[model samples]
Target: MSTTNQFQQAAHYARVIAAIARDRPVPPATLSSLHVIANQLDNAANFLDTDAPGPLSSLPIAATEALWLAELFAEDNPATRLPTDFTNYVLHRITGRPLPFPEPMFPLSDRLALQEVELTNRLQYLHDDTDMQVAHPDEWLRAVLSLWQKLLRLAEAVREDNSRSSHQ
Candidate 1:
């Protein structure tokens, strides 16, 4: 894919995160992370469009994870599908078990957005409720973080794959 296309994919990932954010309410942590990704994407796209001097490596890192995550969680989602090798990496990150095939991400804009909101609200309550607080949703948040990391792996893997293949 063209560099432009890669950046566009990053935008697409950000859009999905934004969709998730709009779900209910975003936790401060997840909200901050999403905001950072959004800002990074916005800045990266502009720089990339201008033919900036930096390597293409920087832009793809944060965007790859959720695309793969969609394959795992939102399989019915038509918007994002993970490449096979990338899918394997994501499966390893999210679950120890291996996957059989790639799946499409089912688009759940409102549902995801609300889920973030609810999670954030619940997280806040958990933080405040000294008497009734439950455990922080570390696994839940970790899942999201893991998905986000998928892009970074793919980005590096692409560079490494090219380097190795070019030696032939």
Candidate 2:
């Protein structure tokens, strides 16, 4: 897609997310759409120029917004926690060991995109070091594929829930 088109699409999704945030009981279908949009934002960041007011600027905001909406959905049901199994696995696989989590100095926000942020940071870390990239190509690929699969599964789950609700 053209850069302008990507921007327009991202803006449209942002508006939709904002509208849903204004009301209660945000629908699973919308969240599913948000997940897809978030992926697109990530993809756009990959191929687009890192210009000001562009995909690079928009991506983190979009990620934050999508994560916030997903948290809203999870709040209604304790069972609907954010997906972490694949995140943890990818983290371990990339780092070659389980990472230790130190206590946060400040309280964490519900809107925090914990998994996405951590994984992206790790991926960036791997990408920056030529030696690491060459030495662990499989790990890097696995992390990328695993993250995409996790995102797809999350979107599919929301879609499945939406279908089930409509049928009921």
TM-score per prediction, in order, is: 0.25, 0.24
State model 1's lDDT: 0.38
Task: Find the candidate with the highest lDDT and give its number.
Answer: 2
How high is the lDDT of residue 124 in model 2? 54
**Tens digits of per-residue lDDT for model 2 on 1-168?**
444454444344333333332332437865554454344434333332233344343434444444444445434443322333222222233224342222222213322345445545654554455464345544544454444444444445444554664535
Worst window of 10 by summed lDDT in candidate 1: 99-108
**Predicted structure 1: clash tally:** 14
lDDT of 1 at 142: 35
- Candidate 1 per-residue lDDT, tens place, 2-70, comes to 445544443443344334433424456545444443443344334434432235344333333444333
lDDT of 1 at 53: 28
Model 1 misplaced regions, further than 4 Å? 1-3, 18-24, 28-30, 52-168
Worst 10-residue lDDT window, candidate 2: 99-108
